[model samples]
Target: MTDQDTLDAPRDGTKEARLVAALTGKGQTLKQLSALLTWQPHTVRAAMTRLRKRGYVIDRVAKTEKSAARFKLRGDRA
Candidate 1:
């Protein structure tokens, strides 16, 4: 399937599915995702860790110590 199609596909009602949808495009920050998902920051980080374990490439762009890190799905999936 195409990347966009893959992103759009339903994920069996898992939180990861929602996270995938949220991060499909430009991605989001821990705070943004936490707010969007109604989850705590630690919960968001844990979810992201799980996503990585599932073979999803999540890229983190660090801006500054005080700024929240930006995350995006890496396009180069084998």
Candidate 2:
């Protein structure tokens, strides 16, 4: 698909898609993504791995020990 087509494609209702949507324009912590998706932290991490396998770039922002790291989609639209 064209780059724009890839960018504009609708989410297919998968957990990974939902994660991508959530991270489209903003970063969110693992806890926030888990809460938003009603998924466990490990599940969120697995979905992120799948997204990476599918060639989506994800950025992680490290925070303090007491805070969860933040994640966001990088260099692409939702």
Candidate 3:
């Protein structure tokens, strides 16, 4: 999993793979994703950055203050 071929999907790597998988298919919020992934928000952000770079477009939609964030996916290619 070099930097170049890092897709947002679970794409064959063990590290951060589950997090990316949960995010891509489940549309979990940042907080929820953090909890589910057992990762901090910053870790989530870092993983998300790598995911986005690999053609995974994630939109951080602001929802209610109390509710968790609404994660949205963008782009034609995964």
Candidate 4:
């Protein structure tokens, strides 16, 4: 399914679902995620941790001098 389709699934509108959708593509920074969910950065990170525990493969890209850290959702664990 397309990225947008995933975002619009039955769980659409939930913060976690939106976070998954945002990470479905090119990935997003913590700031972006927080803004989208209207949550604090730490709260977003906690939610990501919860997703990881639930078997979602969330990859974190280290921050570089040029940009902030980025997170991408690589789907569930095999």
Candidate 5:
């Protein structure tokens, strides 16, 4: 299947699923994820931690001083 098709595969309709889908593409900042999920920044961070525990390698991409840090999924154990 196409990458977009893979990413768009049926999910369980959970916020976490949406979070992973977002991260599967270009890096996203905490604020962006928060706005996308309608969650607080801390909540998004916590979710990232949970994903880590679940074997997703999320990398923090440093940005210019004027920009917030961005995060992306490096890979998944699965």
Candidate 6:
């Protein structure tokens, strides 16, 4: 799949939610989650994209240039 397609790839909805919840307390980027799960970056990216499209994903990027990004659940909107 193309890069965009890869990002848009499908994943289990509930698992994606769990992943979001797990990442909620702390922020986690797609790369971070990929490294944490030992999965490919694209896999994590895909999950992120799919979750985001479903409105179940939220990411907290660092406000400053030096800070790292994080992942989280987007309030009750999920």
Best by lDDT: 5
Best-first order by lDDT: 5, 4, 2, 1, 3, 6
RMSD of each: 4.8, 3.9, 5.3, 5.6, 5.9, 8.1
- Report every candidate's CA lDDT: 0.75, 0.76, 0.65, 0.77, 0.79, 0.59
Kindly report which residue stretches of model 5 are placed more than 4 angstroms away from their true locations once superposed.
1-11, 75-78
Candidate 1's C-alpha runs over 4 A off are 1-10, 64-67, 76-78
Compose the digit string of candidate 4's lDDT tens values, residues 1-70. 2233333232667888888878876799999999999999999999888876666777887999999988
Please, what are the lDDT tens digits per residue for candidate 6 over residues 1-78?
A: 122323433355655545655565656766667777677978877877767775454556565586557666554322
Candidate 2 vs 5: which has more TM-score? 5
| Model 4 alpha-carbon miss at residue 9, Å | 8.4
Clash number by candidate, in order = 0, 0, 0, 0, 0, 4
Scored against the true structure, residue 39 in model 4 reaches a CA lDDT of: 98
Q: Give the Å shift of residue 42 in candidate 3.
A: 0.5
Model 3 lDDT tens row, 1-78: 233234435546555676655655446788887888778889888988877777766766677878767664543133
For candidate 5, what is the lDDT? 0.79
lDDT of 2 by residue, 1-78 (tens): 223236443369966568878877767998999999999999999988877766677889788878778898785543
